[model samples]
Target: MFADVSGPSFIFWPVGCGDTTTVVVSDTEVVQIDINDKLMADEEGNEHIPIVDELVAKLPQRDGKPYLSCFILTHPDLDHCRGFADLLERVMIGEIWHTPRIFREYEDEKNLSDDAIAFRKEAHRRAERCIEEGGDPGAGDRVRIIGYSELFEPGERYEGFPTNQFYTRPGNAITVLDGADVSDRLHAFIHAPFKDGLADDRNETSLAMRLIIGSEGNTLRGLFLGDLSYPTLMQIFEQTHAHENNSMLEWNVLLSPHHCSKKAMYEDGLLQQDVMDEFADSQLSPGYIVASSNEFPHANSAGDNPPHRKARNRYEEIVNDAFLCTGEVSTPEQVQPIIVSITANGIELDIKDYKLSESAEATLTAAIAKARGNSAPPAYKVGFGAE
Candidate 1:
């Protein structure tokens, strides 16, 4: 279902309160960023989609095995890397992109989830292989370290790793994926986990990137800022401005950072005006903001974690009706992915192809009627016109 896209597309899976985005770069190249596949979703009586299984069924194959060109881990958070081991066992991943945070040992390392540990083991194995092979190391053994730190210097943990060929420092653009040049269609600009921000805080060390798809005037920009808070975001905007690279902040589609946490735009019990201003200035026309979280409540209580109602309200002001929450956008019966197709003309949401089931159509009609303060369903059907 995914590989059939006529051109490039971005597929955001509905993995509640986490992130799992697949970038279909071409018919043969695919890049997946983060994963939150829950095995419990497959248990009897559960209706949640087994996302990894769904992905395996549609991914293009290489030598009779499902193939993924690149797997990017935004951070070592459990939610972000939950299915790395499973994916590794099931799919043939060509390369991996990760921050240096995974290499450092922390006191809380013992508390890490099994999947996070699995990812670290695999990432370390690839890095070691790159060191042994001197450079490139060919596809499956390739690893692109995004961000700089003392750990990568000579005589350090990654001492022999070939930085010249496999490293990408912050504020740089990467045009190559797994050994192929996809500059004509796709390129990603690394934007975060700045040298100073790579501290003990895992959230602060999240890898942020702006992925540009299509060419020149017809390009669609997507900002995937993983879990960064207001201070780091402000730093990014200021640095981009100082370097006259404000274009790096432009975005047509933005995956709302940190699952719609208020921290992304708020600090000290108040909204940071400068950060919000930068977001407003950089947004392209017809912008779309997606929240990869559970459905937001009407209001949030004190100390309540993300998917915050207040944060959702702020994002709604930015994109209005275009603000979508993964938990609420799909049919009531099943969660469907949010697909945005990129073409020579531009980008368009590809939800029109969905043929709503009878129950789904009824649910939509009833919801619309309720919103309109009516007791009966509207005479006209809404949403893709019920087939």
Candidate 2:
């Protein structure tokens, strides 16, 4: 994703029209948030993106396995969890940070999207396996249920089990869980998927996380609002003020919510000043805005908030520094991820020539050898012949 970020970096994958972000927290701990991996091919049998392969190759590995400190599902949308099954089978996940909605659906046998169902199965399996064993479930077996939902009432889902034992709520500043620190460099503020905010639209249930990269006076803040709508964003702004949580609002790099959706910024084809005021108020000087979508500044596109043409322009105006999109930054041939990192002055996109380092190459080889010896399978490709 990045050209070997020695420090901290957030890699926004260039997967068309979807979201898959890998926060390279450090050399050791890496957190993958959401995944949008759909197989697409051309008449010439050329595949667009071999997402799993790229992820496996790009993500750091140790010993004989590719490892992820945490795999956070912002929300169980198909775009977010499409390749999760393969990821679980392949990568060594330390722990999972997921909302309670998915588990609730799994327990109730509700009509869930196919991808959601797949993730639910794995999450349940891992959780059950952890519960059977003693103490904390190491790595892959561990789970952290983020945000307590009314869906999981007493004698309800996973009845008789202490579900709240692992439930982390909004405003929680989580660093370490299950004997593993998800990030050493970033201070994550869980801002959304609030208990009261849960409604019908899955988008509103998105787990919004604001990441701060420094401490004290010198800090680089970034917010990841997962598919939240305009009203929700307003609510976050209002609550942040009401509670006097300055850290939650201040961000040098703001990942444009809902893929530069007007619904996150505009209302009824008009820019909401109240919300824009929030952006203007909290945005640090020399701010950077990154939209994880394709063909940004899509003025004509409608229905969905993603790639809203006006939204992109609005973000550009709001930041007044750098406003970039995943699709527009990288070339179509070999779509490299958009890497935003903390800089000396402020946050900037760490766009560089990304090639596997010699160390990383060795790790890959070792992982391959180990997997081969164990007769373990690699992560599956999104499409045929992509690998």
What's each prediction's clash count? 0, 5
Which residue pairs in candidate 1 collide?
Answer: none
Tens digits of per-residue lDDT, candidate 1, 1-387, equal 245466778877776778889988878888999997742222112223356776677789999988999999998776788777888999999999999887775426555677777788889899999999999889898999898778777788889788888998988999998998889989899888899876746788889999987666667788999988988888888888888889989988889999999998888789877777788789987688998887789998888978888887888877733888777775445547677777656688765344434443444344444545643422421111010
lDDT for each residue of candidate 2 in 243-351, tens digit (9 for 90 to 100): 8786677777788887777888777877787888788788876688888777654357457546888777777777867887777766534446677666565456666
Best TM-score among the predictions, by candidate number: 1
The TM-score values for the models, in the order shown, are 0.87, 0.82
Candidate 2 error regions (>4 Å):
1-3, 43-49, 106-111, 133-135, 150-153, 159-165, 181-184, 214-219, 301-305, 343-347, 356-387
RMSD of each: 9.1, 6.8
